[model samples]
Target: MRNNLISGLIFSFFLGMSWLTKADLYDATLAYQNEEFTLAFSKFSRLAQLGNADAMYNLGVMYLYGQGTEQSAANAFAWFSLAKEFGIAEAFQTAQLVLQQSNDQSGLKDFLKLQKSRLSNTYLLDSTLTKLKQHSTTPTLSKTHDVLPEYPDEAVRQGIEGWVWLEFDIDQSGKATNIEVIDSYPRHVFTASLLNAVEKWRYTGSKQAHTLIYHFATHKDEQYRETLAIQKKAYEKQLRQNIDAAERGVAQVQYYIANWLSMKEYNAYQLLRYHWRSDEPMNELYLAAAKNGLDLAQYRLATQLINAGAHQLGVLWLEHAAQTMDIAKYRLATVLLNTGEPQDVPHALQVLIEASNNGHLRATLLLVNTYLTRLSDKAQAKAWLRHGLIIDPEHPELLLLLARLAENQAEAKKLASQALKSASQRNWSSHAIHLFLQKLAN
Candidate 1:
């Protein structure tokens, strides 16, 4: 928990909307004042998702100050802008202040604008709020007694580490029953132990099925070191092969080695085992692959460059990759749109349309948002929404957007209900659909 409240006025600012009960707001504020940053953040997030304008403001402040979560000027601005839309008068000033204090002010503003576009989408906001309200009433199942599997001696001797994914149901008396091993790495090595342990497990009975993954990792003792030695030998052998392939101008292998070099494991193991390479050459590996015309490598390198603030160069690489990659087109469109330059808007829309035509969901959604919010072309937005629905009729986002744009109340409710039915597939949210439907019924 970080004690970066900025001022006492933040507490008073939490009173903006009536969606949250006074007691809930008080508890969240009290948690923050007591330096229980994580708890405060969780509570405020739940409240904010449920359309509590004040909670949105509090989340913005917390994000700006890195109170319970990572400090993010972009997130702070987004939440503040959302709160402003909900009638929090101070949110605009707070958003501007966050932008002013940001290290990369120009880039921060673009990212913040992107966030605002997302948060301000009425279809998205309603879905989020409705889902939160619904989830609030759902009963949470918890383990009453926990059990861990004892690692098999044979597994230890073989120096094998694996995981088992188990699916089971809880009986009325809170005991585990009907246990089935869904999948396991290294086959049946750990299955018997896992089954035996899970048989004794207890939970607060919900009669609902649940899935759990139990990982068996050997401790970093003598056995683990032996396993590591074996793995390192194999890794070195493969590394030599990959290096040979990379040197022969195999673009895919070059990218693979570059990706491996970028991993934390490579850094940790390189100091211990690989004395042949350093950080700088590994960093250039992606550049080499990109130069060799690996589209994926080009996209990856472009992302790195953009994040590092080399926007012009990144956009150029993105354009090259976008000629063949739908995802790259979407990324290029995002960057172009974020620039907020008049000349960039048409190019952004063009690429987004190209990506959307290829059935890229995110690109389609962005296109709809751009047409609706930026271009103020409701007919184009609706047309794209319809196109998106054709791609994935059950997609909750597209359905929700259609629901919000429906010409009549009955049509709106039907679309919304359809969105709610398919929401579980998207893991979008819960509970709000019921509340929203109830509101519609009344």
Candidate 2:
């Protein structure tokens, strides 16, 4: 009788302990979601000490962001590395981002070396580390092997010498297409010729599609010849006019002036809203500043809206900031691809291609999605997957997509199995991937 009573008490004690453990995790998630970083950090730290991988990851994020603690990239990296040991893919990516942001290339090299030594038994880690090593050594710009085109006679005569910023798509076969001159000097003399020449440039075939930018600069003397003093004055006048047009209203003008003064989006939004009604035309000013071309305003507005739980609006502003034909476009495309609507998919693909062409790591993942789902071009899809693997051999999304393709061919059930394991490792929330894996298991 005493033994039975003791067993019941022991079972109850364990059950209560398990419930408390689950409650603490739930509370930590809620606190994190609510931006109560201090509370979340406290809970997560305890959980992490108890050997919870997810808690370790959450704590890493808190440290990375300086939430409830001083920002410490080193600590963030340490926790993320620990999480990676338990196969948290997001932690691995976060560690890479933290290293990049800190400009700690030496640390990144050391981390990779450590990973290579300690996790040599793990195939995924070994493969990923190998690709990272190879990428670290590769040059950003590839040498052009195609025949060079002669400079346009008109451009030469006009002495056009500044760089012509050209944007184009490079396919899997290394063929450049959809060439467009984004910005250029002596538009009439150089734009068309620059576009034409870039379109004809050939590359060695790559498994992944990338965007490439070629800068064509004329000689210094030629640049002077291209410059027209009066024309330059007129261009400056036009730019001021456009700026004025962008800030036409008193409220709008005030917002800009305040933003310039304070560099705070929330303050600008508050001032603008205080002076103008929500339904008024002046609201367009905020939207334009958020989306049209201003990146700082867009980022600020997006951050504010996200904090306020206006996810859709926040996403729209972030998309605008990300799509501004700038470096941040890659970051914006990543967020958009994760949260935006179906219409955002193609735009995300375009930004991903641009970023990938520029050698951005986050953009590579999007390239896989672009080919597989956005482009819906099977051959291109296969090519991009192969290319992504070159950069990140164990990328879960790439593996999952390839597995789905193989399932269609009925040639490799083993790929499907491996893909399921990879997807699970990454915590991918795709219903289709899940259903396919279930079918393969059956």
Candidate 3:
């Protein structure tokens, strides 16, 4: 039964993996390994057209290094972005590297905009719904354990609201299987939660396919909104007083105003509409608060400066902010690492450790990546990876990385199985891990 479950998980990774597709990918990988760039490029391109994630990543690499095609950062970014969407976690970091290393970013923004539209839930849903109209529907039986999806922290922080449409089959044992994301609003944010929750869902039936849409809202229903409107009216006096204090040079009030201004409209509520326009001059408020030694405002101002290309100023602000903000320390560490200075590496590692100690997940991951990739310290990397696992045991990326660095086949298998379980629960495409396990089994 355990073997069957593992086999089922492995089989899911090969959904669109026809014999021809498998052969082509192997040929492409072999050609690349043999330095036959042109043939490798051709084969990868063919597979990429058929929506192969690994092929897309390889194609991005080819474009990045001018292996068989003209070196094109734009093309590399587009392909890497697509590969990331298809669940290649490293592709996102690669895409960021492309941007950081590129001489010209002229068309990259436009390309990303185009990709966003193409990958949008609305766009994908229209095409998928058309296909579904031709197919017959299957009824869902009683649900035994339907876990409600948790809202993603990043999405909540960004005030992002979206929905995911999922399709999955319920096996004879009342377990959901063969889960797929049909579409998702804002694309990808809510998907992990939906997939993880759905994978645990059980139904009392033989075998059946079911479709579901899960909505993620930061707030409650329409009735809650109506109640919120009344509450906003009650808070109007306090809002006016806060604005008055901000204008009267109260640093805390200034920071509060800036923070409120920077928030999304949904997060800000309707009261903000009564006082400030959409184009509120929040930067000045942030600057004022930052100058007054407000750590939060300093962090906000630092990010704004960094985005606007004031690197030196941003770094100075971040340095100040880092003393109080874990996220600031993380950002500062990333900047130091990107600077590529030998002295900066130690400083970056120090700040990353500080951020990690404060329970910042990205900082921990960056520390692991830095030790493994940049510093060539696998021991340190392993230690940091273990720390991150403590924070998120089910994190597929961390698990997969640890699996790759496993000292022996037994360790590798143990880590890989954990990774496979996590990835399966989240419905993440994990062909590389699947293939690795298959090789080990052989």
Candidate 4:
């Protein structure tokens, strides 16, 4: 009877302990997500002592980044070493990087002895992704072969599936270099795997930044397949209906069908077209609708004609749409610039200025660029950027341009800081700004 009672108490004690550990991990993760790094560090530290692999890894990250703690490579390396023994593969990967960066020869020699005198096959990717592109291609690097990564165990167990977006550079020697994960749908689920795989990829190209997406899925891919099938069916039905309407002489529907017909093969497939009519040429319908003074139809017809190198007809159609549309004015100016020679450069500048006056920021930027480069008028460029800043004080690109134009480093830094803040508010890409800031800081 006493043994039974003792057994019950022991079971209850372990159950409570398990629950507390789970709760602590949840809280730590929540704190990290909330950017409360100090609280995360505290919770994760407590959990790490309890032999939680995830907590150990998190602690390493906090120390490595100086988040909620002073940056200490030794501390991060120690945490990662502990986590690596706990079967967290990422910990081992990072510890490799620590060895490379450590200047203490005696410590590295001892560590190498412990690690069997050789670095592991896996690599430690750059933890910071914003500067990944710059790191990869500024100089030359060694070439490598393709090696696919294994699927993450935790993600597979949880039935989680998503993708990670990475940016890197191809070195002159054709190696994939300085790879970093810029975005991940499920955050940490596939980061390690994506990083490992990209590290081994080789590209035969000159030094340049490149971006790629890695998708992870198991059973969940079927769900996406089903959803896409339904979407395709719906799109096909709409296309058929539009064709019927177009045949009945509806100008809008005629434009829609004509536009679809004129689209490239890949784009038509994206619109769910299993087949296109080879016997039928419907550009005439587009021309008719454009001649009838529909702005969208005119734009579509203009692009179609322009792509075929019928410059005069394309410009004529663009002018017709430009009469009533801001987008048309921007497109016309862009086309004129791209085609060069035989273009009315002065008239195009007028069109851009008129478009900018209509609140088209793209036109403003283009005109500012033209003034800066084509005309070598910094005054006009500065005035335009200042005007844009007045309209939208937090306009990120304008602020970035202002930063670039600033002669004083202090003013440039301030403008870049404001640009980063503004971009973050809108969830816009701030990687370029980060690079600019990094360059200035250096």
lDDT for each residue of candidate 1 in 1-442, tens digit (9 for 90 to 100): 1123334445556544332122245567789989999999997886564345667788888987799999887888788877787667877877766666668877876876676665443323233222322332323468788787888887776556566766555645466543556456568999999888877777775453355657676653356556666676664666677666665456566555555554443323354226326444444555545544457666765655565555665676687679888778887998888888889999999999998999877788889989988998889999999999888778776777787778888998998889888865534453556666787789
- Candidate topping TM-score: 1
Query: Whole-model lDDT for model 1 versus the true structure?
Result: 0.67
Better of 1 and 2 by TM-score: 1
lDDT scores of the candidates, listed in order:
0.67, 0.52, 0.67, 0.61
Clashing pairs in 4: none
Provide backbone clash counts, one per model: 4, 4, 0, 0
Give the TM-score of each candidate: 0.47, 0.28, 0.46, 0.40
Tens-digit per-residue lDDT, 337-402, candidate 3: 889899999999999999898777777888999999998999999999999989888877688889
Candidate 1 at 140: error in angstroms?
29
Candidate 1 residue runs with Cα over 4 Å from true position: 1-234, 266-278, 430-442
Tens digits of per-residue lDDT for model 2 on 280-300?
A: 323234333332234544554
